[model samples]
Target: MASIPTILTTIFLFFLRSTISQQIHSNPDCTGRWIHIRRLPSRFNLDLLTNCSQYPLFDDFCPYLPNHGLGQKTHAKSHSWFRTDPMMLELIFHRRMLEYPCLTPDPNSANAVYLPYYTGIDALRYLYGPDVNSSAEHGLELFDFVKEQDSPNIWARHKGHDHFLVMARPAWDFSQPLINDPPIWGTSFLELPEFYNLTVLTFEARAWPWQEQAVPYPTSFHPPNLSFLESWIHRVARSRRSTLMLFAGGGGVSATPNIRRSIRDECENDTKNGTNGGYVKLCDVVDCSNGICEHDPIRYMRPMMEASFCLQPPGDTPTRRSTFDSILAGCIPVFFEDLSAKTQYTWHLPEEEYGEFSVFIPKEEVVFKGLKILDVLMGIPRDRVMKMRERVLELMPRVIYRRHGSSVDFRSNKKDAFDIAIEGTLQRIKSRLQEVAVL
Candidate 1:
């Protein structure tokens, strides 16, 4: 008979093949042989950390490899360090996780691990220690999970870590034992404090709380300081209206009265014949063909194929849905936010084309700044606006991320804010590990 680990490993490999094999049916781009099997799933899928990659051993089988801690967990028992061999990164990067079979619901795996994935912050904590070094530098068990709990066979570690459960779907329940326990906070809006520790960063600040029951209880619900694609996202050139763009559909309320009024007023006042009226448009709550959520790409792609600028507003304050929607729709986003996007993501929107590709609304001046529809109409000069739209067309191919298996650069570059957040968080973990003598 095989040992428990070996048995588990075998079971994992079986599902891994099934998962990869199923991909040929969905993604047209995944025909070639994959270099390394990425074991993780995307956020739209079930895994906590999507888009990130794992190589060879972890990718080939381990579904529970927390983004940050799996390596450490493996090391704790095997006394073996993860090999940072160049060949490994190349393989992992080539066989994208998005193309795997287990990603879709057509044929779900029955024996797959039932555990949900960890957030990026928890991932950092599980992989790196939660301490800071004098030089702000420290080494972590590279490729370790950030917040891995002890297995059933051993004692659970760090009872203090909390999870912020952001309910993007109403089908989920917060009253349960596993979800209600820890530092989990809950936020219906990306800015609201719903989950315990993690932040649900989004771009739609005004359209939130579709139903009263889903709203956060106890009026003092604090706004969450969640993550974003990067900083500098707020500073970009605006996209043109002639080209088509699309936005995702969700349960959030429609544009508030003030926003609607503002758009109407802009249409009445602007006679210059511009795309101000063209920048944003709303779609039906349910797609005509399917009953899935409005975010489904297959259902939402039509509108995106029609317009150029997708008005990205937050479903909650500070967090906007348009960031992902516009990107996925293959159109440039005209961002409207109370806070600076650059504070969260690093490479999200580029700068050289700042005035020519995207739009940013300052947080402090939002109410005073007026609705994005009107601001977009009156704010941009026709000549400049047209030029920006042209730039968007040029950058569309590089900026848009199609449904595929390869890991995408969520942001623009190495110095991007999201990258900084991840790297900085990793350094903090290293320090904590040293102080606790865990390193």
Candidate 2:
């Protein structure tokens, strides 16, 4: 009974809704998804490094890019430039040395490049959607070649070739040469001998590990380094005009007496001793138990949420899980040490407001100096502590990552840190792309 106009409009609306749904559900094909630990199809699995002539090459150019190019930069020496006798059948290839970008907010734009290599299979799991496992081997080699050709190094040794540069910044330590001090083909980007028409495409940027000068990548790219910690520490120290605090992390390792003792001491000092320092605590009550203490969710998070100063001492090496917990608990983290938190979070609270959320302390100062805990406690002001606590609560959404299994809908038993990194990375990349000028 609908009129023609109304009927047409309804049809259009239905189509539009269906189109939007498809887009939302669709995942990137193998080309866009990064590689991980998966097998490639027999056709693409060919390691051109060892068998270059076996592949179909058009006037020396392979019809498809090789696999080592997908995830991270390949360091294999045998995959480098091909040494041929002009018959095209006897061509032998070796791994070409390539330079990946370093992590830096203000990277050297003049000649910097990115190359995603040694692709992680786990990272691409979501991109392939539910059927990712079936298509695991679909475009492995092409993706790898895409990464390699897009790299800035551009096979410095094999310059005069028609190839796309797979630019990606290294995520781990790849500078150690298996052979000599700069491997066979290992040459700087600027020093590479140019012999081809190359289009540079960047993968993700290299993270921490490269000192500011050692690598041409962003320090915040991979994770936090001593510098990131120092940056935050200096910020907090300047804002609160106080030394940062430390406490054991949560759960098994975190429920130690040191953390509880610190809490009690801080509460008593603030109440009776006129101690200016405040207290914030993070305890996953469900996971911890001592004969004397009862697990109370409200009690555990309340004091921390209300307190201006929270301690974020990491429980494990290489990462500070406490930083994530403290933020969600609504307390400002006084990060006095580095547990590689920066690697996990890059778009953390900004610098101007750094003091408003958390305080950072250098490893040298906190671990080596060994100052009295009381002296550190007395230094921070109560008023500023409250302000920082408020800031933390405000920034919690951006900082916390939720995990509720694979259900599209929210569920129980959530996991946090790793998911937070993925969300943060996506946001950062989106913001970065918006800044590019239209040509």
The candidate 1 region of ten consecutive residues with least summed lDDT is 215-224
lDDT of 1 at 256: 52
- Per-model TM-score versus the true fold: 0.38, 0.37
The TM-score leader among the candidates is: 1
What are the RMSD figures for all models against the true structure?
17.4, 19.2
Question: CA lDDT, every prediction?
Answer: 0.31, 0.32
- lDDT (tens digit, per residue) of candidate 2 on 1-439: 2233343354335334433432343233312212111122222222222232232321222311222111111233422111111111101000111100111121122122222221222112212233233332323344454435434243332231212222222222112223343233212221222311222222122343211111111111111122332343343333432323434334333444443344434433443332333323222122233411121233334344334445654433334433554565555676644334443334354545665677765545544454434455446676776676667655553443221112332211222222333233333333433443231
Q: What is the lDDT of candidate 2?
A: 0.32
Q: What is the lDDT, from 0 to 100, of the residue 286 in candidate 2?
A: 23
Best by lDDT: 2
After TM-score superposition, the amount by which residue 346's alpha carbon in candidate 2 deviates from its true location, in angstroms, is 3.6
Model 1, range 131-216, lDDT digits (tens) per residue? 21111111122112223322321111221111111122221111122322233322112222222222221211122322111111
